[model samples]
Target chain A: MVNDSELCEIILQYVKDEYLDEDDDTQIGPDSPLISSGIVDSFSMVSLKTFLERKYKISIPDAKATPEAFDSVNKIVALMKEFF
Target chain B: MAYADKIREAYRKELADIRTAGLFKEERFIHSPQAAEITVEFPSGAPQQAVINLCANNYLGLSSHPEVIRAAHEGLDSRGYGMSSVRFICGTQEIHKELERKLANFLRLDDAILYAACFDANGGVFEPFILTDQDVIIADRLVHASLVDGIRLSKALQESYKHNDMKHLERKLEEFQDKRIRLIVTDGVFSMDGDVAPLDVICALAEKYDAMVLLDDSHATGFMGRTGRGTHEMRGVLGKIDLITTTLGKGLGGASGGCVSGRAELVELCRQRARPYLFSNAIPPVVVAAANKVLELVSSTTERRDKLERNTLYWRKALTEAGLDIKAGESPIVPVMLYNAKLSQDVARDLYKEGIYVVGFFFPVVPKGAARIRTQLSASHETAHLDKAAAAFKKVGEKYGILGLKKDQIIAKFGA
Candidate 1:
């Protein structure tokens, strides 16, 4: 089983690579705001869910896929842990 | 006056914020009817300029067809204009009944009920069927706003799967097995990407889960299948869809009307309980007659749809050969990917200067960093029009140095 830090690292890396501009130098941490800081939009949030589901073999229901649950890597990790 | 004065400054600040965020929508007034070519006045007081239209939903080119216009005139002369009352009051005319029957026959469903607009049809469809808290409404994430609203009006438990992700949908279906009822909702064709849904798979999933399926075919009804029936026909699942909501304001005749076509029992329930049908005025007789003529024409011949298919193939090929990045699909909606929001707007403005009328789609409409110019093909466009549009697109593509560039390359240059 993937620990919380490893899962957070995976999600942070995916967001940075898929959403951020190539030259963007803003630093992202485990607790950095994704949606609040405009790093991820609604569509991007869905894609992140898909990525996690494919990576970890889990299905995140629509109710649990709320914006607040996906605002930070730690929150997302917590949400995924419920399904696992 | 006191209330207006109190809130005027706040409204101004809100408008200013929208402008600052580049989210304000500006309208271009069309001086002529919607067709392959039309005169448009941009920036309010500007002189009208004629441009080739590539942004309208006129797939079958019946919006300004001479026969349809003539039919509208005949209907106007015969039936008179407005139905002042809603259906079941004084609004139920013979022509209205005829149009609904013709639409039902054309879609191969048991029956159909009309609405003032597809928005109304979608807005009022769900509450009657997905009744009670034990029912669950599972929909695709990318369904249109109308469907989203309709689903929201229901008191049932709401759920959604990833867009076009069948496995995810199946998971949802399996999870909801213990629910009293499961209704799966999806768009027949996604408007932005132009991709058709996998209805065959969806139907099988519904069978396995004992669920009902609803399709919003607003984008694909006029020219999607072998006989232009719908995506149900294209996916070879006619009569299998439990509900289908479509619009006549688009490829049908480009007028203003919509319908919910499906099983007779559900349609009866809608006629009785769907608030839009019972509350809104009837669809005007002119539009009804014009739509009847449209259905008659489509039912009689595949000529227009055949031409549309050819035009779509030719347009997609031309754009691909021009080295522009575009989404791959068989539908008439072709999105030329520019990746940057401002760049899409700039390219659209440049294309307008080149006499091509297309609009840029940016963030919030689509996802961030996925901005594109959505170009739609129509049967009205001749080869010369297609050739001109392709050349102009290449010119704009060259001006922006976006030709032959991949998504990452374009984003690297423009900062998506």
Candidate 2:
């Protein structure tokens, strides 16, 4: 089972792999602001949601696609914890 | 001392910015040809088969038409593949002139000039003719990116009105009253939103403001309005538009080409001055011939357009009746609003799993909180295909709790 910290790490890795940016200092933690900081657009949010759902086998309801659930790596971890 | 390293660092930073902002775009590989049914092969070694493609711009279903294919093959035999030179130099073939003439006749325009892509057609327009400091170009905020790029490259004073907001447009026109020439540029049908422009009203305003109207009918040509003559025909203001640009990529047979149609003088001016047309290699004879065949077919019968209209109405009505929030429009582009980006993505994935191919669009393709599954209707789709697609939507909506449980369950229990 993927723990919250592990999940955050995995997501961060996915981001790093997809972007392949060497100078980016974007850190993934519970308090990281992904959407609010304009770090991620709606399309990336969707992709992240799908990645989580497929990776963790959790069905993210439409109602939970709010800023509180996806605003940061930390929020996503919290949401995953709740689902698990 | 290390320019390459510095450039790489900048690209890395840019990539990080894009990743953080969720602006990263990925392309799906469609292994098979673009048709009503296509096969997409993912990197995971999974191949998915989808029916009645809802994302292609093959509006009149002429991309793989037998007649079009035949014409292309004939052109390949007659004119060879490519000219290897720009039109004025040595690329101007008899068939290119024939295709241009046919397009002009089809659009009911005095003349027309071809471009490599609609992007090029737009990119080459405003720069040459409208760059004077005395000129002003008032454009819709939601015009295609190509138009925006062209306007950016020009020296004309630019003013943008809110998307489809006639009042804002009128205000902009009034504000540009002092310019020597004021050009009102807009898309005949906004592609992403699938809403038709009020060309009649716009023409009236242009007349009142003494401004010329330019319509990019990329989404409307060979599809919208009666006989698929586009927005001008739909609004009964055919000749009123000063300049019109449309893609041969979409409804005009999915050939990789574009054309600017209007008064003979404007077209001649573009032919002479438009950098893309003057410098770029002419469109291959195969594509030109195929487009000519498509024009001939669209002009001959309204069958394809009528069928597409029927499919659009059926899909829109059925989806709406099932309680799905569909964007209001009479065009073939129907946007099923799922508001939530995650839900929209899931719904599209689920639909694809059920053999109905569609794409989920979110910002910056649309505004925030307006994510949707933009489903396009083609003349190639039959009643069964549309119903199947709708059924897939109902299932996905139910699974994701987007639609009412009872209604969705009822439909799912009794398979359509």
Candidate 3:
């Protein structure tokens, strides 16, 4: 089971790996706003959604696929827990 | 100091609103020259190479053509680099006039005027001619952003119809029937959805309403028609459209330039009045020479166009047969539908890992809940390249549980 902190780490790793930008140190917490902070854009959000679905094998409903669930790694993990 | 802090807070709030809505965009870094296949070297050393390049506007495979390169090299030697002057000044070269003449002849238009880009061409078009409030501009709702921006900058009364909805367009025209001069503007092919406008229908509507039709054929110039003459030729209405604007950056030679081809009078008027042409430096001699060569090649041979058509049909059929949703179009721009943004992104990434280069389109670039992978077929891409891509897609579709089950099973389970 991936915990919120673990999920945050994984999400960060994915961003770092895919974007190849090692300088992004923006923290992902339960209250952090990924999109608002300019850390994630629409494309990155899609990339994150794919990561969550494939890694956790959980279906994220369209209604639930909002910033409330995906704004931060912590929120995403919490949302995944609810779905699970 | 306190006021400045408050302003910063407001800006941050607006950014927060955008973030909350999932509309922000982050640009990808491309370290290599634009080509059919490219290597994007990132900082982390996880090297990825992809095919079926989705993001480029390189419609024809002329960007890196040997003939184009040779012409560019010759121009560089003959003309010697930058002009640093506008066309009316000292910037105009023999090649500029030659390319412009070739473009006009190729499109079978009376004359043509060159610009720094298609955006500039659109930006300069409306403001110069249609300044009166009595004039009307009836534009398609889904026309390119440049056209919208151009319309906004003009004083003309602007109305828009729904995307490709001719009845709505007619209704808009009826509402503005008494206007002095009405212009119906549209994209020859919508870039995102891979859908073509009902150009023939629109042309008839223009004739009935006494409106002038202006088509931005950036996506259709070198790849739409049988002989690659564009939307007018494709629809069998070559002499009917009043104005045609297109980008040389996409299909011509993929260098960097744009042009407007139409009536001799309109072309002359634009040359004298258009700000970009009047103020901006002309296209470098090298690019103009290269573009001339490209037009010559396209006019002489239909082999490249035929190959592109065949490639488009094959990819569309194979992807659809694999049970993937593909937006319908005969053009090279093919959209493989993946409603979930994350799924689309994963598919693109996984495909990249498998050595297939494609990009996923999501919200903002596309509408929300309508994310897709916008794959573009190039005349340069071989059958083997396409086959390998399709095989990889099939493998990834099954691996990601996107399309593994039988059709009936999927329909029964998911209810279509």
- Best prediction by TM-score: 1
Candidate rank order under TM-score: 1, 2, 3
Alpha-carbon lDDT of model 1: 0.90
Model 2 over residues B27-104: C-alpha lDDT tens digits? 777877677788875434676554557888877788888899999999899889989999999999988898888888
Span of 10 residues, lowest total lDDT, candidate 3 chain B: B407-416
| Model 3 vs truth, CA RMSD | 14.3
Q: Where is model 1 more than 4 Å wrong at Cα?
A: A1-84, B2-4
The deviation in Å at residue A49 for candidate 1 is 14
Give per-residue lDDT, candidate 3, residue B235.
89
lDDT by residue for model 1 over B214-315, one digit each (tens)?
999998988999999999999999999999999998889888899999999999999989999899999989999899999999999999999999999999
Give the RMSD in angstroms, all C-alphas superposed, for model 1. Answer: 5.1
Best candidate (score: lDDT) = 1
Instruction: Point out the higher-scoring one by lDDT: 2 or 3.
Output: 2
lDDT of 3 by residue, B1-416 (tens): 66798899999999999878666655555656677677764324545444445457676788888888999999889998889999998998888988889899888899999999999898888877887868988887668888877886787766666568787788778867768999999999898887888889999999999999999999989878878999888888888888899999888878889999998988888998888789899898888888889999999998888888898899898887887767888788898777767777778888877777778877666754567889888888788878888888898888866674543443444332
True contacts kept of 3: 0.00
Positional deviation of residue B322's Cα in model 1 after best superposition, in angstroms: 0.1
Write model 2 residue lDDT over A1-84, tens digit each, in one string. 776677888887765543223565656555767676555643335446645675677877758877667886677777778888
Structure candidate 2, residue pairs in collision? A30-A74, A39-B20, A39-B21, A40-B20, A40-B21, A40-B22, A41-B21, A41-B22
